[model samples]
Target chain A: MRNLHTDEIIKNIKEMCIEANYKLASDVEERVRGAYDQEATALGKQILGQLAENLDIASEDSIPICQDTGMAIIFIKLGQDVHIEGMDLEDAVNEGIRQGYEEGYLRKSVVGDPLIRINTKDNTPGIIHYEIVAGDRVEITVAPKGFGSENMSRVYMLKPSDGVEGVKRAVLETVKLAGPNACPPIVVGVGIGGSFEKCAVLSKKALTRSMDTSSPIEHIRELEDELLLEINQLGIGPGGFGGKVTALGVNIETYPTHIAGLPVAINICCHVNRHVSRVL
Target chain B: MDQYINTPLTMDKVKGLQAGDYVYITGTIYTARDAAHQRMYQAMEEGKEIPFDLKDSILYYLGPTPAREGQVIGSAGPTTSSRMDKYTPLLLDNGLKGMIGKGKRSKEVVESMVKNKAVYFAAVGGAGALLSKKIKASKVIAYDDLGTEAIRELYVEDFPVIVVIDSKGNNLYEIVLQSS
Candidate 1:
């Protein structure tokens, strides 16, 4: 078995955090560029132009794209053939986040307690998700999530009878409710067919997928396209000022579910949907 | 044409503004968000002095990242304004002329704006890097303990914003939503 050190993980995570904040993923950038060209309203176009300019400034100057550098979210695909050595994996990951936030001058938004609400200072204790694979290589993805859209996210526990129409209704309702709030020209990540919490996690995972990529599942792919058209038709526009391009892209992910339930979760993200991935 | 406005915005100036007007504001403004708002509201309730002047003042709902070396401030932009809805009416009642933030405010906050003759402005959310260049200077005025959420007095030059809700409670977001 190939051996991997936590130090390597720590180093990569730290750099990935900085890179994700400074430069948005290319897929997201491309979609925003495409949206800018297609947007109809003058106000919406101006807002989109400013957003594009903001992206340029962020990378050129080596500062974050948005001030809310967001909580660290890491997804790891660890190979079962690889053996990890050094500190506990979780602590090592948190160490990476601490160093990243400190060194990169990213905001420390985490609170130690829900009620007391004290800043953790170091931006530690990241939300990490792991999956074991067959190969010896490890793949890591970092997506720093801003809360403006996170607060607008929703989960629906529909009966089996609800079906695709129910899913459409739920997603449309969430987007309408989000309106100007989710930072329109938003990226919508949708998860379908799982337990409640599982679907929620899946929705967040969906946001990591490249905007140009569609789900491998045939029916799900069609659903993604249809939803994208329907959402833009809502005229939420860029910055929700009313125009044609409401969402940059819609990504849907699904898993097998229990016979009785059809759970759906919608995780919305702003124009600055910061995500970066690396493999080692 | 974008209206060029100077801060310390009065009721008369605010009244002249209309919903959907693009404005570039210069001069002085203060930053305060969740924690700072709570403290300031409690102080107002107890009849204690707030850190900054209340009359004709503008408060921006922002919580910026720490400045890097040689930088005036880090990527600074507007945060979600709806979160501050709880304390907004009180601030409006106390001679506040305008607020800078993103997203929708509550019905009560809008009503308070009508009564107090204040306007609510929104800078494009997530445009922090572009927005920071306009803030020529920034100094934390009070509540340093609140970290990023602290009250920072800022001198801005041509800060871009759109009037979302005007003094008479005319709303830009409402019209956009209806038309859509």
Candidate 2:
């Protein structure tokens, strides 16, 4: 068994948080450039161009790409064979989050109460989601979820008979309702099957995939292409300006559903697309 | 393609703007979001004076991250305008002339812009770091207790934005969605 020191994990987590917020991943940058080329409308092309510029400026300056900087959302895939040596695993993750937000100068947007809000000085106690898997190495992913697109996310419990068309309709309706509010030329992450909460997880997880990769399921792949075409047709251009491209891409993930219901969820992500991962 | 030159922009300057124009704003602006606006408007509701003069002034809907060493401001960019839509008309009625933020605004606010000769601008939502370069200095003027949501006096130079809603009640969001 490989023993990982708690201090080491905490240190790595802090660095990962700072690095992810400061820099746009190369894969994300390349995909934005690719979208700029494929964008059919002049306005859409311009919007993507500006996005590319934003990334460049943020990276060079070592600052966050978006003001929201988001809540520090961490997903952990723990290896059963490995042992956490120095500190509680959860404590290590939270310490990393606290240090990152404070050291990186990122905003502390988290509030004490969802109802009667009170500010937490440092963005602490990250919303950590963990999954245990058979392996020797632990994997971690950090996604900074901004409020705009997160506000537009939705989940629907559909009748099993509703089938594929139901899923498409729900996805389209969500985007349409979102309109310019989610930020145009956005990325749409759709999760089909699973329970309500699990479906939401699947939707967010779907967003972590490389933007250039296609869905493994053939039917879902075709659905993604069709939806991408349809979403762009909505004409919500860059920054919600009049343009030809409404969305940059559509990605879908699925799992077996309960025999009684077909569940679907949609997670909308803004252009900042801030997320980073590490293996330990 | 039209321009609104200079800053501390008057109603005359803002009213002249129309949708689809790119604007370079320079000079002084104040920052406020949900909390500060609510508090200020509440003061106004109680017939008390606001912290700053609203007439001919532009308000940026942003809650910037804390600044690092030697930096005037951190990644300072706009937040969603729709979240502040509830309190905006009241501010507009009290001499607010311009707003800078992303996402859609209420029809009532657009009507207020048309009625009061104001303009609405949009700064790129995710381009916080790039936008921070335009801010020369920032000092909290009111509601420091609100943390990031505090009201601030900011000096900006050539701050890039697009005229999203003009005095004529033209809305770029409506136009864009229609065309799409």
Candidate 3:
């Protein structure tokens, strides 16, 4: 078994956090530019232009793209043949986030307690998800999820008979309800067929997928395209002012579920959809 | 059509604005979000003095990131306005003449704007870095313990916004819906 040092993991996580906040991933940037070119309304075009400029400034100045740098979400794919050394995996990840937010001058948005509501100060205890995979190298992805869109996400457990139409309706409704609040032109991430909680996780995972990538399954890919078209037709547009580019992309992820249920979740992401991955 | 206006908005100035007019505001505005609003509303109920003067003042629903060295402020942008709907009418009654935020305001809040001759403006959401460039200066005016949620007094220069709701209850959101 290949032995991996915890220090390496922590170092990578810290860099990922800082870089993801400072740089809009190239795919996301390209999609936003595409939307800017396609947008019809004057206001929509102006707003999209500003968003592009903001990203450029953030990269040039090493500043955050948005004030809400968001809570750190770490997704880990640990190789089954590798053993972690030097520290506990979760502790290492949180320490990385604490150092990253503090040193990068990113906002520390986490609160220690939900109801009591005290800032965590250093943005610790990153939400971490781990999976053991077949390879010997570890893959880590850091996604800084801002609450504006997170609060707008929805999950529904549909009856077996509701089918694809129900999934479509739920996604459209979530986007409509989000309106301008969640920041259009938004990214729509749809998760289907899992249990309730798993479906929500799947939807979030869908957000990390590249905007240019489509689902490998033919029918699922078609659904994504259809949803993208319908969402834009909502005329929620850029910043919800009114235009033809309400959403830059629609991504859908699915998993098997029990025979009686058709669970679905919609996780909306704002235009500043920030995430980065590293393999070590 | 972009219009330049100064803060401490007057009824005539507000009346001149219609739904969808792009505006650039200069001068002072107060910043408050969920926590600060709750505290301010509670203080108002207790008859305690608020930290800043209220008459003809504009409040921005925002919680900016801490400014780095050599910067007046970090990325500062409007938050979702609906969360502040509960406490907005109270502030409006006390002469808060304008608010800057994003999203649809509550019907009650819109009515309060109409009754009080106030107005609502929306800055572009997710354009914080661009917006921060307009803030000339900022200082925590109250609730420093709340971190980003503290009430701040900001001096802004040509901060861009769109008039979303006017004193007469004309809402830009509704206008967009109808026209589309």
TM-score of each predicted structure versus truth: 0.99, 0.96, 0.98
TM-score of 2: 0.96
- True interface contacts reproduced by each model, as a fraction? 0.77, 0.83, 0.62
TM-score of 3: 0.98
lDDT of 2 by residue, A149-175 (tens): 999999999999999889989999998
Tens digits of per-residue lDDT, candidate 3, A1-280, equal 9999999998999999999988889999999877788989999999999988888877776668888889998899999999899999999999899889988888878888899888888988799999899989999999999888888999999998998898899999999999988988999888998798999999999999998799999999999999999998988888888889999999999999999999999999999888899999
lDDT of 1 by residue, A36-121 (tens): 78988899989999999999998887668999999898999999999999999999999999999999999999999879999889
Off by over 4 Å in 1: none
Interface RMSD for candidate 3 relative to the native interface: 1.0
> Mind giving the per-residue lDDT tens digits that candidate 1 earns over B17-69?
99999999999999999999999999999999999998999999999988998
Can you give the lDDT of residue A168 in candidate 1?
95
- Between prediction 1 and prediction 2, which has the larger DockQ? 1
lDDT (10s digit) by residue, model 3, range B23-109: 999999999999899999999999999999999999998888778899898888788899999999999999999999988889899
Docking quality level of the chain pair in candidate 2:
medium
Candidate 1 vs candidate 2: the TM-score winner is: 1
Instruction: Give the range where candidate 1 chain B is weakest over 10 consecutive residues by summed lDDT.
Output: B7-16
> Interface RMSDs of all predictions?
0.9, 1.3, 1.0
Q: After best superposition, candidate 1 residue A24: deviation in angstroms?
A: 0.8
What is the lDDT, from 0 to 100, of the residue B65 in candidate 2? 88
